[model samples]
Target: MIDTRWWQRGIFYQVYPRSFQDTDGDGIGDLDGIRRRLDYLAGLGVDAIWVSPIYPSPMADFGYDVADYCGIHPMFGDLEAFDRLVADVHARGLKLVLDFVPNHTSDQHLWFRESRASRDNPKRDWYIWRDPAPDGGPPNNWISNFGGPAWTLDAASGQYYYHAFLKEQPDLNWRNPEVRAAMHDVLRFWMARGVDGFRVDVIWHLMKDADFRDNPPNPGYRPEEGDIGRFLQTHSADQPEVHDIIAELRRVVDEFPDRVLIGEIYLPIDRLVAYYGEDLAGAHLPFNFQLIYASWNAESLAALIEEYEGSLPRGGWPNWVLGNHDRPRIASRVGHDRARAAAVLLLTLRGTPTMYYGDEIGMENVPISPEDVHDPWEKNEPGLGLGRDPERTPMQWDASPNAGFTAGRPWLPVAANFAHCNVAAMLDDPFSILALYRRLIALRRVHPALQTGSYRPVTAHGDVLAYQRELGGESLFVVLNLGGETQRGIALPDGVAEGHVLLSTRLDREEKVTSGFSLRAHEGLVIALSAAT
Candidate 1:
């Protein structure tokens, strides 16, 4: 055991700063806006807040493409504002985690500029630059994640630079010792500033295969059915050299006590566990994205939970994320009716839970008109329409103009009928999904079993999902209906549990209905284990 502390318990609020709050009237969010929302976050009872990248960038990849590792981006406010935000977050008993993008940098960044200045510059080898093929083509056929060639020809240097993502953001050559040292210095700079931790970006893609062989063709590449999931680029990337780099990053974290590193790795659970490092020196939590990939069915999820728990080595801590900026929000995945059940299950699960900014109120993805879309993904794919703008819509504070995001038009349109799903209205209505989330968090806090308990799956037929969490002296049973129809006679196995319905998002109006506890359609119930029985 790693001697768990304050960080091990409770939830984390992930704020996508650009869409979180815009303190300035420039139609963009900034650090000061985050400072203003501290009380709102503290009221939500999360131990810390994870801010997406606010570093200097050209906005090509929207802050993911960094120009300066240590400096704050002018659009997100200056360095002083970040310092103040850190101080304010700490003052309110909250930890602040900044996003670190060590995988790549904006081509406009000085480092890339220096590297491009000459083929023999001291920094030329810091980034991956390759020679053109015999036919004046890209070095390889590997595609950038955003589409097109991953390699871009630099006219000034007469060489091709590699970017796993966008051409504007060149990937760093971690194989170089200088590059690794510089990345560590970036960590040291932030640690010196009192920042609590970093959300390391693209940890799995840190190092590339040395031979640079071509990725095998995807025989199962079916765009209509998401068959790209099976195209393993075996000879292309995710090399073993990545572990050496992770150890170096872990060493930097070790120098600063209590500082944590969370990785954005997309590997399977078995491979993901290796990121925890042999001596617990790698990523503190290589994000478990199983929920995103699992079939939205009860039996499959139950099996996945069992597998997820079984895959962890003793002393390895697990973290669960339901939504992020890149994926569709949780409400959109399973639809609005089942959002509460998802919330109950997410909060009730026994690992760190991360909630997207507007997920608490059951905010669905907005409609992204092709003409108004800004995501490069949508731009590249054209008809695919898989961009993230809809999920990343401005937070709906109220039903007012622009959803109170700004007096000016928001960067993206707010969801239609915002009046019905606004946070302000939800706060006013006692039966709102927002209130249900607040209660769900409170229940998790009040019950030690819910926070750090051992999870056990209960067998049940149909779309009914059931599980139990047990701790030192208490246990709580969770019953959820993931489908539309009502499930009944959920006999609680041997019915040893005798406690009243602890909380329910749907049972509020029908408390006296029957069965002592009957789950309504798309509903959830958390009941304490009755002591006498």
Candidate 2:
């Protein structure tokens, strides 16, 4: 058995705080609201909660833009409220991880305020600033993730400053030793105040090449919205310098025993593993995003799983996430009919799985009208279906009165379909998605094979996905029917024992029931085997 701490093996639920719950009825979710919902998470069987940023900000990029690293946003609560939240969550045996935005800071941050004061300000080197082009434009043609030129020319200082994201969130120049020390100190301050670790924000963007050369255009034709998707390469951004900084950050985390450090890396598999470092002196879990890419095909998923398992660093743990505040939720991605099977795939995987808020109830993306759209992405890429507001809507707790999330209006409107999809309604229905989630979590606890097992793929074809998870001297095989009708006689590897149906959610039975098994639409099973039996 793995004797690791709870942080190593426990399931984490990511909460987009602004949309989770609202206690004060000010159209915004707050820490107090999350405090009231602690029992619900405890019941859901999650070990920790990773709350999105709640620091003071102008709300340009929601809470991702931080005006103050140390102060709580008054909209969320005060220091006492935050303290109460920590105490309450710990009382529930749950750890809390705050979002750490080390890559950049809100343009209004005090350091930025002082740095932008004059050309020769003492803190001027804290942020990336450069002279304008000969034509007196931005430093280069490089674009922000949001849109337009990454460098914004500041008339006051007669220089162009860098921002990989929104202009309001300026990139910090990590080349300055003082800036690196300050970011590290910000992390230490949170650790002192009882934060478990950090979900390091935009970790790769913390460092950039000194030469402000223009990024080459894509060879393939594309709309100007997403990245240069012509090739899969992420050449300019994922620099090797990131490893040294991660080494330093890991040292800080080691100071506090059992503290967790998860990096939000959007790089490919090979590049992602480097965050763990050769000596394993890096982040605890580089967040896995394969589930997002392989949402449609079982064959692709099986191949990706094999590749990911083979790519892990020794002594390093694996983490899987199906959805987050940034991306569209899984239910929405895979369509409603396939989400249940996706749930089985998620819970039975051998790594720690993270459930995005509201996913348990199978929440669909709430479509946004142009008039009500708040995300800058949609604003920049209108009609491109690129806005994030759909997935960031308020949580649905009940059927009436703003879905029992807020007494007042919500920051983003809940889906009209919440009348059927909600906690109160699902709590009574055994077959509801929320109940299924609860059962899956409980089953994981009941069988150690589901948690600490080694995954081996079961060979199958055409809409039938099968795999075995083996550990603790036992193996549990799982199969899912992705098609609408029943599927029969799928195949497993050699040494297959006659299988007894452990659990099946299908409404159909196979005719032959050969070395493989049969499953109806969305039906999934966990069957175990032992050499002694």
Query: What clash count does candidate 1 reach?
Result: 0
Per-residue lDDT, model 2, residue 454, is 79
lDDT of 2 at 14: 90
- Model 1, position 500, has a per-residue lDDT of 59
lDDT of each: 0.82, 0.82
Off by over 4 Å in 1: 1-3, 224-231, 493-497, 507-517, 531-533
- lDDT, residue 328, candidate 2: 90
State TM-scores per candidate.
0.95, 0.95
